[model samples]
Target: MVDIAKVTTELLLEETKTSGHSPLKFICNDGYLYYCKYLVDFDPNEINCLAYEIVSHYLLKVLNIPTPDIALVKISEGTLDKSKIIKNRRLCVNHICFGSKGIDPSEELTEFETCSSKRDYNRILNQEDVVKIALFDLWINNVDRGRFINPGFNYNLLTVRSGNKRKILAFDHAFVFGGVEQIGVFNSKMPFINQDKFHDSDFYKSFISYMDEEEIIKIVENFIPLLKISHKEVIDAAIYQLPDIWKLTPNLANRIQEYLFCEERIEKVKTVILNSKSIY
Candidate 1:
C-alpha cells in the first residue's frame, strides 16, 4: 500500500456538473488541487469504494504505472455542498477521505477510444503501455477502463499531449473487484486466478495480441515490489488509513488483499492473458 498523504480540503473547486459518476474536484491548503474519490458511500451495499481506491493506487504505484499523486483528505462538515457530488456517492458531513492528485484544466488532458477496431484505435495507444495495462487489469479485474461507448462517460483513457510529447496518467478504479454489478458475488470473486472473463475484458482483449509470456514475465518482474510487501502489512495499512464511516472490516480487507500479492495467482493471471492470444 502507498504512504497515502493526508490533507484537509480548503476549498471545493469544481465538481461533476454532469450526470455521470465523476470524482469531486477541490483544492487543498497546499495550493495543489486534487480529485478525491469519496469514502462516504456504503448504501448500495455493493462496493467498498475507499478500500478499492487505496489498494488500486498503491498497486499502480508499485508497478511504476504513471498516475497522479494520491492522498487522503479530511472533509469537514459544510466544507463542501453535498449536493454537488454525483448521486449515490454523496459526501459525508465530516469524514477522512481518499483520492488522487488532480489534473489542472489548463493541462488540456483529452480522452481516446479503446476498442479492437484497428482503424481508429491503433494510432492512439502505445503497445507497451497497452500491454502493461492489460496485465494490470487482468490482475485487478478492473471493469471500467474503457466505458467510452456509453453516453456521458465523462472520462475515458484520459491523456496529455504537448508538442510531440504525450503521456497517460491513470486514475479511476471504482469498478475494480467486480464493481457494483457483481458486488453480490465479491464473496467468491477470485480475479487473480479466474480466467473465465479476463480474456474478454476490454483492457486485456485489446492489447493481448501484442504480448507474450516473456513480456508478461518482464512486466511482472518489474512489479516485484508488489510481492515484496507483506499482505498482513497491506491489510493493516488499509485498516489504519480508512475512516470509521466506511466500515471496512479487517476480514474484508484481507479478503480483498488475498491473492493480490500471491506469486501463484500472478502467474495464473499471466497465463490466462497470454493464452488469450491466438498463435495463427
Candidate 2:
C-alpha cells in the first residue's frame, strides 16, 4: 500500500509546459521539489484529472512499474502569484493537490524525438520495462503517452541518469481512462481497450529493435500471471485516497475498478498482445 503523505508547498519555482494539467514545480516542506497539479477554481471537471492521476499512480505501483513518488500537497493561500493564469484556469489555494517528486538530471522521452541509437537504449537500465509500460498504458486506456492524438504526442515519461545508466519513470496519467473530459461517457459495459500504440511508436520501436521476438514474448508472458492476481485491495485503496472535496463521481470510480480488473478484459488484453504480433 502507498503511504500517501500530506505536505505543504514552501516555494513556487516555475510552471511546466507539461500537457493538459501543466503542473507547477514547487518545493514542498519535505524538502523535495515536486511537479504539483492544482485543483482549478470553479472547475468541477478538474477533479476527474486528479482522480485519474492518483488511481493510475497506485495501479502502476501494483504492477511494479517505476514511477515518481506521490504526495498530497497542500497549497497555502498566496502560494501562487495572482498574475499567473496557470493551467488555463485560476489555481485553487488552501486546498490539497497532487504532487509527484521531481527527478533531477533527467530528460523526457520527448527530448529524444525519434532516437534511433542503440546507445540510447543501452543507457536505459530498465529497457525491458518499456514492454511493461506499454501493457499498463493499454489497460488504463491512456491516450496521452505515446500517440499524437488531440493533445499531440505527450510522452509523459521521464528518465533519470545515474553514472552510465538511466531509469525510466512514467508519470502524468491525468488523461487515462479515455481522458479527463470523457469521464461522463465511461461505464462498466464500455470496452477499455486501445491499440498499444506505445509499442508502435517510433521511439518504442527504436528501443526494442535489438530484442528478438522470444525475448519480448518472455517479458510480456511473464506479466499475465501477475495480472491474474486480484488487485481489489489496490483499486479500493487508490479510490479511497481521493478526497471528498474533489467530488469525483462514485460511478466513475466503480467503472474504473471494473474496467481494470475484469477477468474477460484481462484475457482479451493477453490475447491481443500474443496474437497481434505486438512483440515485434
Candidate 3:
C-alpha cells in the first residue's frame, strides 16, 4: 500500500484565487499550508478530479517530474458546514480529501514574465524537467495546463524561487484524462496513447529550445520500462490506495489502470514525443 502522509484540516483560510477548480487553502494540523480539494454537493462527479489528482501525483513522481508533496487531508465533521464561506462554495463534508502541500516562495509560471526568455531558462535549476512534464501531460491526456488553441493556457505550472535560480513544480491534474466530466467516459480504448495535446502549447514553447530531440527520446525510453515492471503491483497500488470516499469505483479504476498501462499505449508515448517539432 502507498504510504501517503495524512493531515487534518484544522482551519479554513480562504478561497485561493487560481484557475481550474478553486481548492480551499488551509493550514493543516501539520503546521503547513495545503491547498485542499474537497467534495462539492453541487456536482458529485467532481470527486473524480480528486482521484485524478492523487493518481497523477503518483505517476508524475515516478516520471521524476518535480511536484508538490500530496497528503490525504482529514476534514473533521462540520468543518465545512461550520464555515461561513461554505454557503457560497457548496463544499461537502467528505472526511478525506486531496491536499497539495503549499510551497513557500512560489508563484505561477505565468507570473514570471520572462519565463519565455533564455535568461529565465538559465535560472531554472531543473530546466530539463520542463521537457519531462510536457511528455507526461501528453501521456495522461491533460488538456488543462497549456491548451493553446481554444480556451487558452490555464497556467497550472508553478515556479518556486531560490536565490537567483528557480525550480518548476507541476501541479493540478484534475483535468487529466480529458477532464472531470470525461473521466467517466475514459477507457483503455481512447486514442490518448498517441495524442499530441502538449506540443502546441506555449508552455512547451517556453522550453522547446532547451530540449534536445535525443534527450526527449531518451527520457521516454527510460519511462517505458517502468510500465512493464510488476504491472499490477505498481499501477494497481495507486488505485487501491485511494480513499473509497472519492467514488473511484472498482470498474472505473480497472479502466483507468488499463488505459494507463496498456501495452500499445505504453509504447506510443515515445513516438508521439518524437513527432513533435524537431529540436534540430
* RMSD of every prediction: 4.7, 2.5, 3.0
For residues 1-280, write the lDDT of model 1, one tens digit per residue.
Answer: 4466888888776675432345677788677887765534445353366677777777777666766777877786556865565552556656665657766542422333234555433444444555566567767777655444343222334455544545555676767777666553564335343533334544445545545657665765565445446666655675666666676644666666664656666776666545556631
Off by over 4 Å in 1: 17-20, 39-47, 82-89, 105-127, 147-156, 181-231, 261-264, 276-280
Alpha-carbon local distance difference test for all models: 0.59, 0.74, 0.71
Residue-wise lDDT of candidate 2 within 1-280, one digit each (tens)?
A: 8567788888888877754677888898889998888755365776788878888888888888999888988887667654555563556677778898888778887734654677776778887787788778777778778776543355778888888998888998987887765776765467655553576666776667756667778978898777767776776777787777777776766677777767776777666555434444
Best by lDDT: 2
Model 2 bad stretches (over 4 Å) = 40-43, 149-152, 275-280
- Which digits, one per residue and each the tens of the lDDT, describe model 3 over residues 1-280? 4567889887787876544566788788889998887765477777788888887888777767899999988876655644445432655455687899999878986632334677866888986677677667766778777654344555578888888998888998988888865757887787653333555566666666666667767776776676645345545676777777667644666766777767776667656666664732
Point out the worst 10-residue segment of candidate 1 by lDDT: 105-114
lDDT over C-alpha atoms for residue 162 of model 2: 81
TM-score of each: 0.72, 0.89, 0.85
Q: Decide which is better by lDDT, 1 or 2.
A: 2
